[model samples]
Target: MALDDIRARIRAAEAAAGRPPGSVTLIAVSKLQPADRVEAALDQGQRVFGENYVQEAQRKWPAWRARWPEVALHMIGPLQSNKARAAVELFDAIHGVDRASLARRLARVAQETGLAPQVFVQVNTGAEPQKAGVLPAEADALIQECRQLGLNLAGCMCIPPDDADPRPHFQLLRETATRNGLSGLSMGMSADFETAIAEGATHVRVGSAIFGARPTERPG
Candidate 1:
């Protein structure tokens, strides 16, 4: 019933934010979770899931997709340029497009395959040195570049500083998306999704709250 609870919370957040019901998409972050956990969520009508790694998704999702054809998979972690083709082929949306090189690669893949996933430019609102997103100051250029590349530039995504308030970061992402004429805001996770929804997040990636904790050691 955790999935249902999370959905209920999302609905409440939507209502409280004065947004239309079902305005926010809940992407169950299933990366690193056990197959059974994922299946249970799928059975509960969770059709959208987020994965962090291309290889992991490739290994596990095809069979699952065969069984649940309506499923929508999203790439929510750092995406490497080398994996752009696979990510384009496998995911319905990519939420970590943070650089021009990756954007160009995605465009090339789209040209080759005649298919491209919706993409969100990742913004490092916190300006964290170690994070894998474009800095807030550089977001517009990247967004412009992505649009120029003929990619389906949907919106913006962000991971706020771990120890700081996330609402400001969410606000920055929302503002950036608005300036770029984008509507999608993939800027929330389990801990701060409500705040993100309040700040106009169109997609919230929630993991542990839905599927429980991930194992410490990932299988190769």
Candidate 2:
């Protein structure tokens, strides 16, 4: 019922944003949620998913996909260069590529494994000192660098400052993607996804709003 309700909300957001009927990808963030809930979503036809940790995803999704092979898993959290190979192996998309070094690592691993995942370069639109993204100004260069490394550049992703009005940040990410000839903009979360859709977000990562709060910050 919650999944259906969320989908309805997303469709309404799409309509309100003047986007096409299926312009947005609704990635149910399953991190910190249990595997049973994930299966529930899968039964509800939610194939695209987002997870924060490689090990936690590794622990849960493989067996599920064996049964439901069409699932598309996305890595939507901070990525370590050391985990590039695993990310490439497991994720269908990586939405947290924030630096050139990590890009290079992923490129090399993908070339070696021949399993390159779709990549989204994260931009710190608000220039927040504590966030894990390339500054907005540096996004162009990093995107170009990612292209140079031969990554499958799907588009740009950003996490706007939670306390600020996220619409401007979403617009900036959309413009950055367009200027760079990219088609995807992965912005927004549970709170402002409707506004993000209005500003042209192609992907929205929603976790707690759908699955409810996690008992712990990290997966057990």
What C-alpha lDDT does candidate 1 achieve relative to the native structure? Answer: 0.93
Clashes of each: 0, 0
Q: Give the winner by TM-score.
A: 1
Cα error of candidate 2 at position 7, Å: 0.8
**Stretches of model 2 off by over 4 angstroms after superposition:** none
Q: Give TM per candidate.
A: 0.98, 0.97
lDDT of 2 by residue, 1-220 (tens): 2788778888998999777888999999999887778788899999999999999999998899999999999999999998888999999999999988999899999999999799999999999999999998999999999989889999999999978989889989989999999999999898988888888889999888788877686865
lDDT of 1 at 109: 95
**List of clashing residue pairs for candidate 1:** none
For model 2 the TM-score comes to 0.97
RMSD in Å for all candidates: 0.8, 1.1
Model 1: per-residue Cα lDDT over 1-220, one tens digit each = 3999999999999999999999999999998998999999988889999999999999999999999999999999999999988999999999999999999999999999999799999999989999999999999999999989999888999999999999989988898999889999998898999999999999999999888889877646
